[model samples]
Target: MSSTANISTRTPDQLGASRAKAADNSTGKTPGPHRSKHRRLWWTTLAVGVVAVIVNVPWFNALIVSFKSDGDISRGALALGHPTTDHYANSLGAAGYDFPRFFLNSGMIALGAVALVLLIAVPSTYAAIRLGFGGRFIMNASSALRLLPAIFFAVPYFLLMSNLGLLDTVPGLILANTFLNLPLAIILLGAGFRDVPIELEEAAQVDGASTYRILYSVLLPILAPTLVAVSVLVFIFSWNDYLFALVLSSSNATPITLGAANFVTSTGIRWGDISAATVLSTLPPVLFAVFAQRFLVSGLSAGAVKG
Candidate 1:
């Protein structure tokens, strides 16, 4: 009996040890998945950070160089021993290109284009998405239009503008920008409008709302974020467009882009002044991007899934 009892006690001890070992094994194994997940997250973060730095480095370098003198910039030197505001001062001063005039012209044209694009695109997109009138053909045509290079239409556009006596004016640039940006605006806003629940519109209509009233009160509010995104995109496109401005605009209606291009003379290129102006010129887009980044991301993601 004593021998059996001793065996039983030893067995229990052995079983307890086995259970403890198992518990330890399970506990230790749990960290493996966590470790792997952490590793993956770290790698993804590192990759994104690296990419961001790579993309932003050129702009950062240009900004730093903008404050430096012409000689300092030419040497490709990192540290500016004699940094000065001369470049900015010169850029803004009478001696440099008329930055103020150019800025104003570009702003007005971009704002006008964005406004018109939104006005036309929102209604068209609504009709396309809600009414479904030749939706596939419309989308396909817009995509195909993008495939054709902008320069292809430049000659035709120039001739048309000249014939209409609309050449070298803000109105001409505004119209050109609108046409160029309209397709993209329609694509984006159409996708946004489509994502709106049909039930909501139906409910609005059931409440004795007219089509225009339903759109204005119900749809526009939901599409506000997307509208902001499209506006920023259109503004950037219009602001940076050199080719259209070059071809369409003359001395009286010259935009900042054309003015910047003209900075390079036959004799020499003014690197400091050019870089300063470029940096300054980039501010509006940058500011808009920074402010609208969240909306932009949301709009793009939502549009992509629906579109």
Candidate 2:
């Protein structure tokens, strides 16, 4: 009788709240780790999205303006109300700009630079890392060189090229780009070389494999992805280089980077034409990156994990 009186004294709301609490306890599904992890993931995604937006907004705007006409652009609105290909046409050839020639020149020089960089960097990195042939000093020196401004070597390089009669030539640009790209290539290749195990070479040697043979058969295969990554990177760097091209190249060796400057004249800045050229210039590297991103990601990942 006393228990019945006590239960009757409680309100319906109180009884319902008590029953819900009992149900929750029975399930044993509390929100601590799961909820916090989800919250962190959400914040991380939001941050990445914001950063991407901020970085790409200018490029996106440029892309939109590239498709608009000169008259439309003059109106000062960012809309592509009347899209036209005149800018692209002008960039390609309609306005006396031999962009295709510039493209070919840049491609040749970039490829040449990549070839030269790999030729020297690969063997030197192997010797330094595997043979301990002054690896530390080489790495330190390369890092120091990378830190210095490119302009520091401008005059010296210019005089050297002039003496060699290499100024305003394709070979001149190739050598210049090679010098510019070498240090970073060495650093990157060194990292990749370090990721490779010495035991593989030793094992090959036990089977009477020469050092060259072992490097060719064993190490090169493992380093293939890294090589591709380095090649793509060096290609892009060589392709986009403007300062050296400006100082070294003339009509015979002029790259698209230098070619794009033609759009700027006393008549005024050709915003539409320049933007179109910029878009064209950006395509090769973008395509290379997209195609080789798998190798690049894997190579960098491998280098990051030393063991």
Candidate 3:
């Protein structure tokens, strides 16, 4: 009884020390959660850095080649030999490349296409979501149409535009690009539209506001961010279009994407000029995306899709 009482009376520190000694003697180690966590963090950071490098390699190579001369490119693709601005000068069409004009042509077509897409898609999406009887069918049909590649429409559209005397013109490119953007615009803008409360729309209707009035006065203000998102997407789509521009237009409507092919002359591929043009051509969309990022954040923060 006395021994048991003494054991029970032992201080907590002594008991803890005994248990620690026993544990050390038995296993000689303990695995810490923090050590494993640190290891995982290190590996995750390394993987992210590696992925970023891989993704940027082509753009980095383009950047390096843009500053280099044609001779330097021949020496090595990754090598940074003496850099010069002559490629940019030549590609800018001062030396007869027509880069500026093609860039302007791309902008006009992309912006015009965005306008046409909005003009058609906005009303159509509104009607489909709010007023149309067969909204699901309309949306499903749009999705089905998207599955049909834009290339499938190219030859037929070329013939149709040619018949209308719109071939090889900016208007021709605008019309084709608009068609290309419609499905995407409808789907995206429609998602935003669906989030709007039907109650407000009903109230406006009860007050005798016309359909167009409620759409413009009440809903559009709330949908500004979403509208910006759709506009940017449509602009980028038209801006980056190559196949349609290549198949439909020849000279006056050549976008930068198609015009980039001009560097493949009979004398051999002009690598430096091509690189310079690529860098220039990529700038607008990149800049636009950068600028529009604020709107994207604002829109998402403003509202979300409802069940």
- What overall lDDT, based on C-alpha atoms, would model 3 receive against the true structure? 0.79
Q: Which candidate number maximizes TM-score? A: 3
**Sorted on lDDT, highest at the top, how do the candidates line up?**
2, 3, 1
Instruction: Give lDDT: candidate 3, residue 27.
Output: 55
Off by over 4 Å in 3: 1-32, 288-307
The TM-score of predicted model 1 comes to: 0.80
Candidate 2 lDDT over 112-165, as tens digits, reads 999999999898888898888885998878777877999988899889999999
Ranking by TM-score: 3, 1, 2
Whole-model Cα lDDT of every candidate shown, in order? 0.79, 0.80, 0.79
Candidate 1 regions with alpha-carbon error over 4 angstroms: 1-47, 74-76, 94-96, 132-135, 298-307
- Candidate 3, residues 1-307: lDDT per residue as tens digits? 1122233235666664575556556654556644654665688789999998999889888888889987888887656678899889888876787778899999999999989999998888899999984659877777677778888898899899999999889999999999887877777677778878899999999999999999999999988867887788778889999898998888888999888865555367788888888998898777875676654333333322210
Cα lDDT tens digits for candidate 1, 130-244: 8886777877676566567999989999999999888998889999999898877877787677668899999998999999999899999987877887888889889988898
Q: Which 10-residue window of candidate 1 scores lowest in summed lDDT?
A: 1-10
- For model 2, the stretches where C-alpha displacement exceeds 4 angstroms are 1-47, 132-135, 294-307
